[model samples]
Target: MYGVNTYADTNFASITLDNDVFVGKDNGYTNGLYFSLYNVGVGLRPNFWVSPLLWTMPRGYAENRINVHSIGQTLTTAEDITQANPPEGSLPYSGLLKYTNTHIVVGSRFTDWVSTSVGIVGPAAKGKQTQTEFHALIGAEKPMGWDTQLKNEFVFGFSRGRAIRVLASRSDTMDLLAGGQLSVGTISSGVNAAIMLRLGQNLRDSYPTVSLASSRASNPIAVNNSWFVYAGVSANYVFNQIFTDGNTFRDSRSIDYDHNYNTFMTGITYTIGRDSSLSFAYLSSFSDDDTEYSRQTERLNRFGTLTLVWEF
Candidate 1:
């Protein structure tokens, strides 16, 4: 939610005996699950109050659970990453960079088209502290394109306290967002964006952030039962991803220079059963500006992910 951008920092990290590498607060993995808790966490309301109508129009909560895995290269310097071949001390020049993340989310559908959710997220095994996130969302599936089969959805939400390590309080934002999604035959795609309007001691007014993801579940194969495979790509463009990282390597987030250039993602998912599925993906960021001049950039190396899901 809040730290989805590079400027938004989290205090999470991990290292294993087998592969002693640093996996920062987040592995740079982004999720793209259809039944994702975020699909309706803050449910489309620009306002925070719950609608009294929802109480009378809805039944009881319909619960479900899911887990997501993310993997990618470690965060390295812009120089090292850009080099064709890094020197010896820069050992990770190749694939030594690996990051894994796991997320467990619990969601409930309050109405046929509305849901609310909360979740605990952490490293797959090592680094940083844990984080919690919650949200409410609402959407309607209707034809968005000329093709009647291309059902589209308009969704909106609000999320807060996503990083247990930072702003655990509701003081700053993690506030609002809205977007559009489409389901067409064997494919689905979405684009969502947000802007931080409310200013705080730890935050700066930022430009609107945007992200896009898409998947296709077309390859079919039958083993124990019918199964299908899908692949997708996603990208996030954020301004000032880390707003307050006053450090030696970097300091002070500014719109003129410091901002998240972009993070790119690609992955595959498989439906093994009616209620179970699996997915794997990779990520890389390009914010590598190491200059004091305005309009410069900085970047993070690479990372990846794996996700397991089950729903009812």
Candidate 2:
């Protein structure tokens, strides 16, 4: 048996300032905090051919609190005042919240040409306002020739609102994923690429929104009929018994919540001796919303990650 654990904490802050020849003071500032915990465990077969089983768990929390002030009076929904000159007032809004998640997964490979895995995920606490989700997935691949390969996968899952009643509203929503890949040149050292697509949906609930109306209610909106596409490329090199591979990456993990979008990533790996190696990767997302009110239309958000691994 093998096990590992890690923890991390990070903070971000920003400020902006403007000075005009004939205007009131103009400046703004914002700040945020993030914390995380991660853990993993594994068991291996002595022969290294029967395969191994691994499990992983991670948890994170983030909060954004901001305040804005202007030398001029800004019109609130309650104000009907017109202004030819800067108004004399300040308007500020701030928010604070925390979230927790729990995950359990089991995976194994049967041979060099085929593999499969599945998992269950949900929140650990009750009375918490968060979506509880469950997922199951399986995948397989086979060598098509000396220089090419084919693969396919399928995923089905469901997400529930804050209460059990919301979960029972449906038999459990469904999702699907399928894909394939191909390579050119030497089977052991060359270039390769793959494309994958995903489709899924979620149930409706009492979500929040900002509108001119004083009250909001839950409505039956179409849940499902969303689709996503991902593509990536990689290069591999081998010298004697040592080898290395690097690849551009892509993913659509958050497409269901943020609307259809795409992410790009790149990574590198080096093999040492015959049965062990290390690798690192980075990923980022891009906007694809067509509507003016979508979050991606207002601001661009990006993320970066690093990973290391050893195999035997």
Provide the overall lDDT of each model, using Cα atoms, as 2-decimal numbers: 0.23, 0.18
State the lDDT of candidate 2 residue by residue for 154-221, as single tens digits: 21111111111112124223212121212121111212221212112231210000000000010011
Q: Write the per-residue lDDT of candidate 1 for residues 14-77, one digit (tens) a residue.
A: 1111110222322112111122222212222211121322342233322321122223221211
Model 2: which ten-residue window has the lowest total lDDT?
Answer: 207-216
Give lDDT: candidate 2, residue 312: 21
Question: What TM-score does each of the candidates earn?
Answer: 0.29, 0.23
Candidate 1 lDDT for residue 170? 61
How far residue 299's Cα lies from its native spot in candidate 1, in Å, is 5.5
RMSD of each: 20.7, 26.5
Clashing pairs in 2: 73-87, 249-265
Q: Best-fitting candidate, measured by TM-score? A: 1
